[model samples]
Structures are given as C-alpha cells and as structure tokens.
Target chain A: MAQLFWDDVEIGMEIPPYKKAVTLMELNRYAGANEEYVLIHMDRDYSQKVARLPDVIVMGNLKYAYLSNMMINWIGEEGTLKRLSAQYRGMDIPGPALSTEPTMICKGKVTNKYIQDGDHCIECEVWTETNEGQVTTPGSAIAILPARS
Target chain B: MAQESLITDEVRAAIGVETVSPPELVEMKAIKDYARAINWPDPPNPLHVDEEYAKKTRFGGIIAPWCFYTTLGRSAPRQRVPLPPARVGMNGGNDYEYFLPIRPGDMITTTSKIVDIVEREGRAGKLIITTSERTFTNQNGEVVGIAHGTGLSQY
Candidate 1:
C-alpha cells in the first residue's frame, strides 16, 4: 500500500469506477450469516408477489459496503476514511445482473479540500447509478490524506 | 400514528441508553478472509508487510478494509420469529462518522443504542425501519468511530 500525498490529489479528480452484480449465492450467504430472514432478500416468489420487486434483491448494507470499498481503495494507505453518508434510493435485484444491462456505476469526484482542527481532509460527491441511469444510492465521503513529503 | 404504537412506554424507556465496551483488534488476515468469503473482486486490503506502510496506518500496522464493522462480530439479541415470515427485509444504509484512528492491537468494543423506530407503508406491507447508533471505542476509552444504520422489517 503506497501513501498518497495530499499534493498528488487535485480537485475534480475522479475516483476510478467500480461495479457489483448481486447473485443468489451471495445473497443467501449474507442472509445466513446475518440471520436476516427477510423473504425479499432470499425468497424470489415472496419478493415478486409480496414486495413487488423484480426479484429477491441484495441487502442495502452490502451495497453500501461496495460503495465504501470503492472509496477506501482509491484513498490508499496514507488516507483515512473519515465519513460516509448514503441514502437508499432504489433496489438492486437479482437476475441478468443488476448493473450489467448497461453498467454498474460507482463514481466520485473531489469536491472540497481543507484542514479541520489540524486534520487534513477532502470531501467528495459520490454516487452509484443503475444500468438504466437511475441513481441507486447518492452518497458523499470525507478522507484524511497524508501531507506531501 | 403507527409509530406511536411501536414506541410504547416500555419501548420508550429503552431509548437513548448508551452501552459501552472495549475495541476489538481487527486482524488483517480476518479482513482478507472476509473479502475472500464474499469473492469480491480487487480485495481492498493492500497487501503490505513492511512496517513503514503499517506504521503510517492509524489502525496500527494492520490494514483493514473500510467495512470493518461487518467483520467485527457481535451477537444480536434474540427476537421472536413472527409466524408467516415478513415479506421484506433490507438494510437501509449506514452513516459512518470517524473520530479517532483505529489502530492495530487495539481491542474495540461497540456501544449500540436504539435511536428510532418508524412504521411506514411500502408496496409490500407495513414496514418498520429501526435505526441504531453505535459508537466504537479503543481500549483506552478513546472514541474511534461512530456509525448509524437502519434495519427494515416488513410484516
């Protein structure tokens, strides 16, 4: 893990994109581990008839984790994940892949840079949109970057 | 209001109560194993063994993935299983506010408080979103991080 000097990053810098395709196997594993017996996350018939979902969908936390994972990996070791905020906007259903029809989109652009009480920080406008151009989760993050040597 | 019924006097008494505990030292190996378990691509754990890279990390030398909370294990209080299972269940989302750096060799304990519970009508049925605010503290009692998450249960 290489340290990213504050000077190396600039405003408008775009964090690389990331994609996630939820699967039944992954969904079942999460449900089993968390002991969440919500039919919509595992039972396809229940989700379709009861929840009106296209199919059983991925859990919201896992989606958020995917977004968080993207940002953390972009920040590297010298950077610290300070804050992450997200709103659940839509669902990611199983079948034909959630983001595959077009693409599973995870993109972020640096929006602000500053020092808060001695902590070097950068704020970003981040989001994940579905294949059809629907914004699934709108989010933002703050990271502490190491000072340039 | 539907929320009023859910927040009975008995439940109201449980609000705003803070539970504290020591931090659990998250291991790098555990983080890597979790990613492997999920089979997620581009494992987030930066493969590094040099002390220099580890020393710069607030998490001591161990580089933990961002979603370490999922990796941090805690048993959920038992709940009665309602007959005819709920039709929907979802994780609303999470808001993480970082305070202190989580260092390696540090034992982390989480303090979780039930913040709010609201009932709403979804396409499926009566849905409940229970929000909980959890704070993580190191062994020295230093506040490390705070997270807010919601669990959606539909009946």
Candidate 2:
C-alpha cells in the first residue's frame, strides 16, 4: 500500500470502503479473542429466548474494531490513529438463514485537515452500513498522516 | 403526578467512583489473535502480526492494534451503580483517544470510573445512560490511551 500523505488529502475526499460479511464463526473467533463470552452473542437459543432477539447479534466492540481496521488500512504504518468514536444505534444480525443477510460496509469521508501540535492531522466521519441500507454504527476518527515534505 | 427520576441518590453517589485493575502483561499471542479475529478471511496487518516487518518500522517492534486495550484485564471486577431493573441493557457507544501504541510485554494498568449518569425519555419508556471513563497507563507511567464508554438501559 502506498503511503497517504497529509499534503495529498482533501476535506471532502472519501476513503475507500472496507467490506465484510459478519458470520457466526467470525463472531465466535472474536468472542475468544476479546474474551467476551456474552451468551447473547454466541448462543442462538439464549439470544432468542433470553434476550428476546430474532437471532444472535454482532458485538458492538467487533464493529468498533472493524472501524479501527478500516482506519488502520487507510492510514498505513506511518500514520497514527489518534482517536475513534462509534455509537451502536441498531442491531445487526448474521445470516444466510435469517430474514436478511447483511454485508457490513465500513465507509469514511475526510471532514477536516489541519496541523495540530506539530502533527498533520485529518479528521473523518466514519460509519458502518448494512446492505439493508441501515447505518447501524456511526462514528468519527482522527489520524496523523506523514507529510510529503 | 410527576414521574420519579431514575437517578437515585445511591446512583448519584456512585459517580466518579473508581476501579483500578492490577498491571497486566501484554502477550504477543493475544495481540495476534485479536488482529486475526478482526481481519478474518483476510490477513492481519503486518505491524500487528509480523515481527520482522514491524521491527523495521518506526514502532521498532510488534505493536498491538490501537483498540487492543479493550481486551486487557477483562476478569477484573469493576464498580457498578445500583439501578432499577430494565428490560434491556446494551453498549450504547465508545470513544477513544490514543497517545501511544501498545507493545509486547508492556505492563498496562487500567483505572476506570463512572463519570456521569443521565435519564431521558425514550420510545419504550425511560432510558438511563451511564458513561464511564477508563485510563490506560504503561509501566513507565506514560499514558497510552483513554476511553469513554456509554451503556444504555431501557425500561
């Protein structure tokens, strides 16, 4: 991946979208990795009967991580992720069997570009939208990118 | 008659109460696992998984992803405010500010506290929003990151 320089960025530029399909196995792996064993995220019966959900749902932390991944990919090794924020507004279910199989699309647009405390900083509006056209997770991020000089 | 507020005196008193966890040693394997889980199907970033590649970078060594702090010291007990029963509780959101990258073997200590509680009317009925702030510091006493988490309960 080519390095992204602050000099090359524009205020309205949109970063490439990152896409992923949330699956049950992927959720299980995340559960182990994060050590979050919430039954509502892993057990179908528990999610339906106990949580009163149609099915097991994706972890909000995982969606946050996805947004982080997207930022990391955009910033590259030289750039640093300074801040990130996300709000879990809607529930997203995983499926091939469920009513709708949603693909998680992580998208971002550069909102501002400036130098702060000697670092070239870029602020962006980030969010995750499902194929069903729902913005389940909306957020923002700030990153420090290297300058061409 | 006026409806009673969910922010009881006990709940109000719990604000600013802190819970500090013992220092936790960061492991390379846990970092790799977390990166893999996030990257699944696709290979994880070399900065997180490949030591050879990372050693050549400015970080000087493999560094965990910025959000990796969330997994640290999970089993430690946290202070919680007493509240009325609600039909559902969920993670409302998270806000993070990063100052440094987490590297292998860094002794990370976390201190968390409930900062605020607010009540609002929702479509369901009453909604209680609790905000907690956690600070992560390294062994060298350098602050690595701070996170603010919001949890919501609906009655």
Candidate 3:
C-alpha cells in the first residue's frame, strides 16, 4: 500500500471503505481493554430485561474506537490525525458488520489551521453505516498530512 | 415558556472545576488486547507489538491507540455532585484530540473538569448532559491527548 500524501488528496474524494464485523466476544474483549464494567454491555439478560436492547450492544467508546482506526488507517503514516469526533445516534447490535467511509472535505490551498503553520491539513467527513444501511455513527475529523514538496 | 432548566445552580458551579487523580501506569497487556479487540491487525506492521518495528517508526516505540484514554489514568468520570440514584445514565458520545499516543511503560495522569451541564427535553423526556474535558499527560509532562466526552442522565 502506498502512503497517502497531502498532494494526493482532493476535496470530496472518497477513500476506500473498511468493514468490521461485531460480536459478543469482541464486545467482551473491549470491556476488558477499556476497563469498563458496565453490566449493560456485558450482561445479556440485563441488556434485554432492563435496557431492552436487541442484545448486548456494543460499547459507545468501542464504536468510536473503530471509527478512529478507520481514520488513522486511511491517512497513512506521515499524516497526523488531529481530532476524531462521533455521536452515537442509535444502538448497534453485534452479529452485523459496520462499514466506514470518509470523504475529503478540504480543497485546494487548504485554508485550514495547519496550512497557516506551513502544514497541509486534510479534513474529512467520516461515518459508519450499519449492515442494515443505517448510519449509526456520524462524525468528522481533521488530519495534518505531509506535503509533497 | 422558558421551560424549566435542569441546569441547577449546583451544576453550573461545577463547570471548570477539576477532579484529578494520581498517575496510573499503562500496561502492555491492556494495550495489546485492545488492539486485538478492535481488530487493528498485527505483525508486518507490528507498531503495537514488535519493539524493533516500532523503533523504526516516527513514534520511536510502541504506541497504544489513543482511545486508551477512556480508562488509562482517567478516573471518577461521574459528576462530582453525583446524579440521583434513580436517574439512568448512559455514555452520550466522545470527541477526542490526539496530540500523542500512549506508549507502553508510561505513567500517565488525567485531569478532568466539568465544562458544561446542559438540560434539555428530548424524546426520553428530561435529560441532563454532563460534559467533561480530560487532559492526558505522560510522566514527562507531555500531553498525550484531550478527550471531551459527555454522559447523559435521564430523569
């Protein structure tokens, strides 16, 4: 895979999308990684009986973590991810896969913050869509990429 | 109608005040498993594992995904005043800025401050949005990242 440089980006360009299949094991594993002891994410009965969720839904942070991974992977090594933000709009049930696609939002001359400092910063509208074709997490990011020059 | 504001004086007073804790060590096992859980992939690009590979990279060593800030060194995210026992609370969202990555064997500390508490009437009726800003700093006093997240309390 070739590294993505600032010169290679164009506004409105869509990077290749990536997919992640969710599972209870992944969720449980994340619980240990994140040190989150929320029973809602761990206890199936509690999630169904109390929270009334479809099943033991994925952790909100874990969902965003997946999104961050997508953003970092798309930009490549020289690019620095400045910020990542996501809003959890709906519950995401495991057993389904989520696809992430990020579209370039910065155009020629790159008139954003980094450019003033002589850095080429790329911005993207990043989002995750569930298997059912619903956008579960919608967010945006700013990445500073190395210039070709 | 002005609509009764859930932003009580107590909540307003909490804004900008910080609740900090001592530094917590970052363990390798925690970072490694987290990478696996997220399916970040391994080997060939072993920045998360192989020290030799990491040393050749710009980061100069293994770096955990910045998301590790969720638990690393961060403590007591619950509102200082504490929400009523009856009101159910859930994570609202996460907005993170990564200046640096959490490296293995780093002793990090987090400083959390309540920035805002917005009260609104939503589909679930009464809602209290507790927003906090956290700064992650490594042992050498370099900032790792800033995480501004929210927790929603439904009354």
Query: In candidate 1, residue B2 scores what lDDT?
Result: 36
Please list the C-alpha lDDT of all candidates, in the order they appear.
Answer: 0.67, 0.88, 0.73
Candidate number with greatest lDDT: 2
Give lDDT tens digits, candidate 3, residues A1-149.
57888887777677566676666666777887777888778877988887656777778888787777776677777678888887777777776323233211111122233364787888777767776667777777888888888
What C-alpha RMSD separates each model from the true structure? 4.4, 2.1, 4.3
The candidate scoring highest on DockQ is 2
Error of 1 at B77 (Å): 4.7
> Per-candidate TM vs. native?
0.77, 0.94, 0.87
Model 2: per-residue Cα lDDT over B98-149, one tens digit each: 9999999999889888899999999768899999898998999999999999
Top-TM-score structure, candidate number: 2
Q: Chain B, model 3, TM-score against the native?
A: 0.84
In terms of lDDT, model 3 sits at 0.73
Candidate 2: give the clashing pairs.
Answer: none
